[model samples]
Target chain A: MTQASPEQLAAWIQRMAAQDERAFAEFYDATSASVFGLLVRILKDRTQAEEVAQEVYLQLWRKAGSFDPERGSPWSWVVVMARSRAIDATRSDRSYGSALSDLEARPTAQPLGNPTPRPDRAADLSEQRELVQGAMESLTEPQRETIQAAFFEGWSHREIAKRTGVPLGTVKGRVRGALATLENVLRPQLGEQSMGGD
Target chain B: MEADRFQELCEEFLLSGLEGEELRAFREELDRRGAEGGRILDRTMEAMGLLALSAPPVDPPPALRERLMAEVGAGTERRGESAEGSGAGSTPTGPSLVEDAPAEPASAGAARRDPSGPGHERPDIGHSRLDRPSPADAPYPWVRSILLAAAIVAAVVLGAWNVNLQSDLSERTAALEEAQQELEAVDTLRQELATLREDLGTIVSPTGSVISLTGTETRPDARARVFVDPQTGRALILAFDLPILTAESLYQLWAIRDGEPFSVGTFTATEEGPARLELDSLDPVAGADLLAVTIEPAPGQPAPTGEMVLISGQ
Candidate 1:
């Protein structure tokens, strides 16, 4: 997937904070596909995900002033908001039990189509994805599964334990261990640019 | 918390796994560490963000862009109108256009012209073209003036009502937040009570013994109880009416056996005076003859280095 550089994204966000419509449009175009994809994975419903995506952007517009680059990258901020809202929607929905079941049933390996990147940056984007995928593959099966359940399914430690039939402490340990490994593996490839501060 | 522990918790925090006391402690630690803590948290979050990027991107529905832009355009227009109206004073003309114009037809036209193809059609609820007044039915000039005046009055009243409603909403939201906090507090208390009940049940069983410790000559009014299960090493101390100590001091518990004292645990009591300490796995107290409480330096001493305030059978 194509992604904007932190500097470019931060510039768009700063302009958006000033109510610059053009900048907002650019920001939306740059981030919407990945944001929607993440939401669909979490919510497992496209229509609801679309609605929540709209709300997420609207919130970004309204709360733009609160964005601080020192905290993290703008994309991370957006993804966090989108995931949180989608998870909340799942919780409040009456069909949450079935929705959760649907999430688990969905295949993780299905290819989500490539996002269109600028012609010159296409190779760069491809390389970035490979690095991330390589790092993800390095994890042990249980560790990857535990992290996936927590991240994509929004399962708490207890819920993940119940779902996976692993002990709660073991699940926590796996998650922590997996993240530490991923951080170590990806940090060098993703580089300090991914750290998000200007 | 140690750096490793903090990093572990930060990972949990990033995954939305931390809640309740753990979440609170993580936040406090983040605040206490200030910018340095924020950087650690940011790195954790950024790492998670990379994980998110691993998800394959799917194209958003094309119509979403048109819908979003239309909404933004409308919002900007409304903001512009409001700003202009406030600056120009009682112009009532701009608001009249807003009240009189058929908005749906214009929005439909804008949607149709959108290059993104036929966009998702929002329901035209209020201002259909069919609902527009015909030119032949237009009111006389004098009647128009009166209608404008009435519209202005209605707008003023509605504006006042809107302000009142906003204030009411704020008050209601505050009340709801306060009620939620109270409910959480009650939930915590309920959990604590349940734990206490289980402890009491264990202590009252056939294997249990309750030891009452009274104040010594040094502190005449202090009192406490030690509930222990002799078969199991589990013990709980409930201390009451003990004098509050300085920050540098703590109250310690000891099990006395064969003329020697073994450290139990130490606790600080609040001014209201009751404190409960649970020892999950204690040294076997089967041969212990008595329990005692003493005031010692903060964190307490391995052996009693302070005056005995309460002892079994005073």
Candidate 2:
């Protein structure tokens, strides 16, 4: 899977809005790995992830016109869509929700299991990973855990509060605080780049 | 809503955490703020998207891409052939985007890439919640005093609530489940009401453009009306007396701008009543010269490639 710049990805999506098959292929190649990776991480089951990935791509193909560049980068739009679908899948999977609710009895979140870490081949992506990882490290442990649980485990703010024995409002505060720190740390990089990878 | 509280909900929304009544509240606050709220959401989403990149990348199975491409390719061909069969002469191939008034030219290539372009410009929208230091972060003397007072009051209230919460957890959980079910039903009604309200707004707004789409030679009884809000660049279509589609096909809406047809989206007509489709991003319609609808293969084609059942202005 090759990476394309945000501009290139956005342009491909524009072509896709016009039903350009070749551009669709290019967009898929450029972003499918990241999308699939996020789905796998959130869903924990590879098979389910693959199914959702297929659905996400098909939605992307049909709804490319919905990609409003002014809203955010094409990559972010894709990631948000993929994550939302994966989270929805998790919510609908009764067993998963039950297990999560059951596990909330304990203070710790139930681990999502180990992900097969494919080494970052793209230098730019590695740099981004490092920047984000470093910024994540800067967060207080509670804030980090809360944000990660929400982002990766698809836990709601209320769910996270229940799981961690924290108040609902505090969970909201931690997530917001973490986001503020990330925005601050990533400000320069975000300003310089096109809001996504190449 | 207070700025800090609203900002917290916005962040939760980005994380997919807002739901039920809270979700409705967040949306209401956003609606109240209008465009500024929208900008806040965009920025917050972009910020949240950054975290996704930190996930370790993994390449998908090669078969996945192949399967996707195969389906896409087949859909294109099927739609193209269907178009030719209809004597439309247009294919489900090539760029159907308006050449002169290209839909959002910034999306095509250059403008977004340019650091100096308007695409990159971050407007200082009064108070910046996402990037700039928020009030909670850098509060004024008076604001800080008020926040301090609020925190003390909240602490007292929470202390009292905690004791009751401990005893009420079991009962509360059951009540919560029942409330969730109720909220789900209410959410559905809310969504329908919202759509109707939006359509009504477009009908009454002075800037709204309502175009009547008349049935073509094949189906003279088929008809539709398009309600377009130029300000939001959203188009709502209400079609009536149209032949309902089969399981294998759908009705695709198209926006014709400068003689070029862009697929707005696809939907199926109901057998008993009019079918409605509310498009979120038919931005080109503000400048669109015409609106058309066609019957296309199931799952929708990127371009229109079926018999034109309805066309604007006869």
Docking quality level of the chain pair in candidate 2: incorrect
DockQ of candidate model 1: 0.18
Docking verdict class for candidate 1? incorrect
Q: What is the interface RMSD of candidate 2, in Å?
A: 15.1
TM-score of chain A of 2: 0.77
Complex DockQ per candidate: 0.18, 0.16
TM-scores for every predicted model: 0.51, 0.50
- Give each prediction's root-mean-square deviation over alpha carbons: 16.2, 28.4
**What tens-digit string does per-residue lDDT give for candidate 2 at B118-224?**
33534334435547665667747687778899999999999999988887997888799788879767744554455566667766778877889999999999899
Per-residue accuracy of model 1 over B1-314 as CA lDDT, tens digit each: 54444656776665654554666688677666655555566666666777777777878998998888776666667657667755543332222222334344445544333345443454445556458666568766678778889999999999999999999999999998778768766754554565656566656868787789898987778788888775645677788888767544678787889899876666767754376665544553446788888887643555788988888865
Lowest lDDT sum, 10 consecutive residues, model 2 chain B, at B94-103
Chain B TM-score list for all models: 0.45, 0.43
Relative to the true structure, how large is the alpha-carbon lDDT of every model?
A: 0.66, 0.67
